[model samples]
Target: MQFHHHGYVSGDPRVRPAAGVGINRPAELPDEVDVLIIGTGPAGMLTAAQLSQFPNVTTRIVERRAGRLAIGQADGIQARSVETFQAFGFAERIIAEAYAITEMAFWKPDAADPSRIIRTARTQDDPAGISEFPHLIVNQARVLDYFAEYMANSPTRMSPDYGFEFRSLSVSDEGEYPVTVTLLQTSGPNEGQERVVHAKYVVGADGARSKVRESIGCTLAGDQANHAWGVMDALAVTDFPDIRTKCAIQSGTGGSILLIPREGGHLFRMYVDLGEVDPNDKGAVRNTTIEEIIGKANEILHPYTLDVRNIAWHSVYEVGHRLTDRFDDVLPDERGTRTPRVFIAGDACHTHSAKAGQGMNVSMQDGFNLAWKLGHVLEGRSPESLLSTYSAERQVVAKNLIDFDKEWSTLMAKKPEEFENPSELEDFYVSTAEFPAGFMTQYAPSMLVAAADHQELATGFTVGKRFKSAPVVRVGDTNPVHLGHHATADGRWRIYVFADTALPGATSSTEEFAEWLASSPQSPLAATPSGADPDAWFDVKVVYQQGHPSIDFGAVPGVFKPQVGPFKLADYEKVYATDPAADIFELRGLDRGGVLVVVRPDQYVANVLPLTATAELGAFFAPLLPERKAAAVLSAATEP
Candidate 1:
């Protein structure tokens, strides 16, 4: 038998405040397209690429910039972001050219010698076992380049039209494209010329001054951070040993500086503390240039020699933390009916200091979270209510991010005397150590994520949190594979049967597991109409402690892999058993078996229950999914 990858996409977004709504049908959508993405940054491009997985979904992306970005943007890719990248096949491309920042060294002025700075602490950049990849560095422009290449190769492809600016979006009564977009050409011969485009959905990936956000009536609320920072991405000459590594340098007199090693030609990125700059002063921000930033770097790293051989790009920015109150929105048509046709992501929805590198990664993750839900609704597989989760999840993440940036940016600007408070420093460092890895993000329970009450279930692999991956072996073959590889982010909800058939003192029988699966009324996914697409609806698979020698491959029951044809299996693509090479079960806190876990399309644990609790599973999905009129079908079949 040959194995092939099933085209898929996964979603992982952030936390948001709670609100309530039932799914309401739009009056109608026009004949234009399924999706339209505005602003071709990582957020917009990623949303376009993921939409390509659905063959029937039509997509278009537009950019206001004259061309691709040259420089000066977010560059850090955390562990969770790497996993998200791997889903789209761009992780290796980045890893090939980009620098993987594994170790972080912190420097402070020597206690007895105030003039010289010494290493205070050194540790791994990411927590162990968080992900397969670590924190990585590449310019934001290069990241956009990778997204462009992926979109070019997608099965359902769309290219971005540059120099196009979005003017406004209006809701329509009915047809294919319900949302009408007004666009203006911003550059070239067609500059100032206007045109109109129709789309069923419009995503705003424009920057902080997002017109889409304003047009839709969303407001950003937060205070400007007191510190001013200078960021420089350049190819430079330096004698610092840890310059090659990502480091935090704290000066006794001048201020603090952060080092980020880039991928191309020995480039390095620096964020230098420029002290307090007036928030109202636009000239203050514009006046600080590459030379000014370089001079500041010299002040911070006094003992270490520095020279800028060639600066690629630089910017002077104040830490102004602001976030929108909402993420998902329903724009009113001329008559004022609400439909969730307009949305926003990335810096458009939230803006803050570049210190944590969450801007690019979080924006892309938002795209990943939303694209598939739109794909399902456009294809008529899922209910419109699913769209509400986007605002619910991502807004929480944005709020948490703003709160964190407040403490961190303040500490970076404070004098050494303020660092004497060990508790405050420890709290800030604890967050610094955790949040950037992209693992700390967790969503609260709502309509989508129904689960057993278990928060400490194996340390972070709880209900409403991300489903971590593990290594297991195939039943017919001893080949080892990470279970996560099978749970591709391609937008399929999964029900995992952690089979304990071979475990000692196990009370649950294989027959019981098989029976529950075979009965439509008893299975959690029983509500899905019989004719529904398996690829789009739900996937069933099993994992076990070990395969019993007594039961031959042919003797394995039909529930594990069902049969519709002569001697063919039904559901099981591959049977996975524990692998001895790695103690993955222990690592993920899944050593105890005989449980059932329901995972959302975005790869988060939606529910966890006993293997026998199929009814609970059915109840969980009942509210969120469309129901099948099975009785009508059965009546027609009987009459025929």
Candidate 2:
């Protein structure tokens, strides 16, 4: 059987003597899917896994490669990515499989400078009060495997249709779920088949060379540095005590080198400047041949003599820094609307130097940010305009990463003479915390406009909200329960009752609010009798003064309101202070019956409505509550 469509052929063609190859195409095609994600990397896979939890939507992932491999790529997980892993339900197992790097030591290569040997540790003792998760070092493939396992266990079993590569896409301006994709299955037993996939939305997570991005005609706009770096993964047989510690060794003769410890005993990654090696040579570094790379490594670590043996895997590649000019196209005059019904994220959206190990984390978070919005819109719970926020929110994140990568690349390439000022080194450390933490916050809903005000917020209560999406916190305990451990299947809006104590007013407020929410026609909140019930729609918890659970609060400064603060009337003063404006009540038209804080699905405060404003509740939820009737009407009107 042969199938053919648009110059591509699949299957065996048995035509006379020396016949041409034939192609096969499926007769039926899916009319439209909730989401069509391109690429099977961490970004695409995780998005598919998150969306698979929603039964009402269909999620598909496509990959160019046919199978998973054990090669090590990214070897470290920042504290934030670990927290994300917790949400995806694989933090513990990942922690067990990865090596924990507690300390990082930097050394100077000159034997003449003994002081450089004891370079101050960036994080001497394991950082305290930084995050719930510690810094972990694991292979990138292992992390991908974990996600693959989770998706397989899920009811949806989100396996990518491998060998199927995206060829091109067509978009509609009429806005009737505007994107259609043409895909070709290029390999495997049933290779050369063509299929058309129609989707309400498309996510371009197809890595640096994304075909989806190409179809959209979006160019990544940023600088690409000329430097090439050699990355080697090997086991060190050296007697150096600090070999066990992650370190950066800078030698005058050779070049700058970075050493990282991996999961297995003594396995380490050595990054060297390719300028130090002969450009024409291409060789693999393994346990037996690792000694060849060690000579250059020794030159980089001049004062400390090192031995190399037992190498696992290694590769060399050029590094670059490039960020897309726009996250997605914004059509003129359509202030809140995005074009093509298509979005690009992850490496597809931005590519930068890999010094800080941010590519994986940022890419994963990008998927996280896009997945929820796509799921909700496909399920008919949110407006198509909701998709616009992905670009609005993540574009900033992409820019920040590019900027940090530039600075970090400079810092890594700095000479010992430039490091005389301790303040300069301190600034680099501060920058590290800032970039990763900021990227992590993009996944948080509290940073969005809808999460700004809690009362009028529609989607804030679901798994999408930052507070609700974040790990669980015991009322009095400092340690938090991983949010991933909780059952987050319900798609209802969440109402968190922040109260002083179990007073009559507090109890009455909680009960009345629950009752009102249960009865309100516009309310998406569901009533549950027991607070501890796993299947409860509305999550209610009282935060008392003595031992209240402290929220992560994310990167934005003023999401939390302080109990005591002076009123600042000036614009500049308001911007400088961490406190919300004292007259915010007037701004949001709220009155104290314990203000109803409405946070959006993305977790940014949407509005602050008074608990007593029952009459205005309908208008508040107008945007979030699905207008099935309106959708039906629109569908009917738009139908051919």
lDDT of 1 by residue, 378-430 (tens): 87767777777787788898888878777677776677767666334434565
Give all TM-scores, in the order shown. Answer: 0.86, 0.73
Best by TM-score: 1
lDDT of 1: 0.70
Can you tell me which runs of candidate 2 are displaced by over 4 Å?
A: 1-32, 109-111, 114-118, 122-128, 173-178, 275-293, 329-340, 420-423, 430-434, 437-493, 504-508, 526-621, 627-640
Model 1 spans with C-alpha error above 4 angstroms? 1-31, 173-176, 187-191, 330-339, 422-427, 430-432, 454-460, 503-511, 518-536, 547-552, 559-573, 583-585, 591-593, 629-640
TM-score quality measure for candidate 2: 0.73
lDDT for residue 232 in candidate 2, whole number 0-100: 79
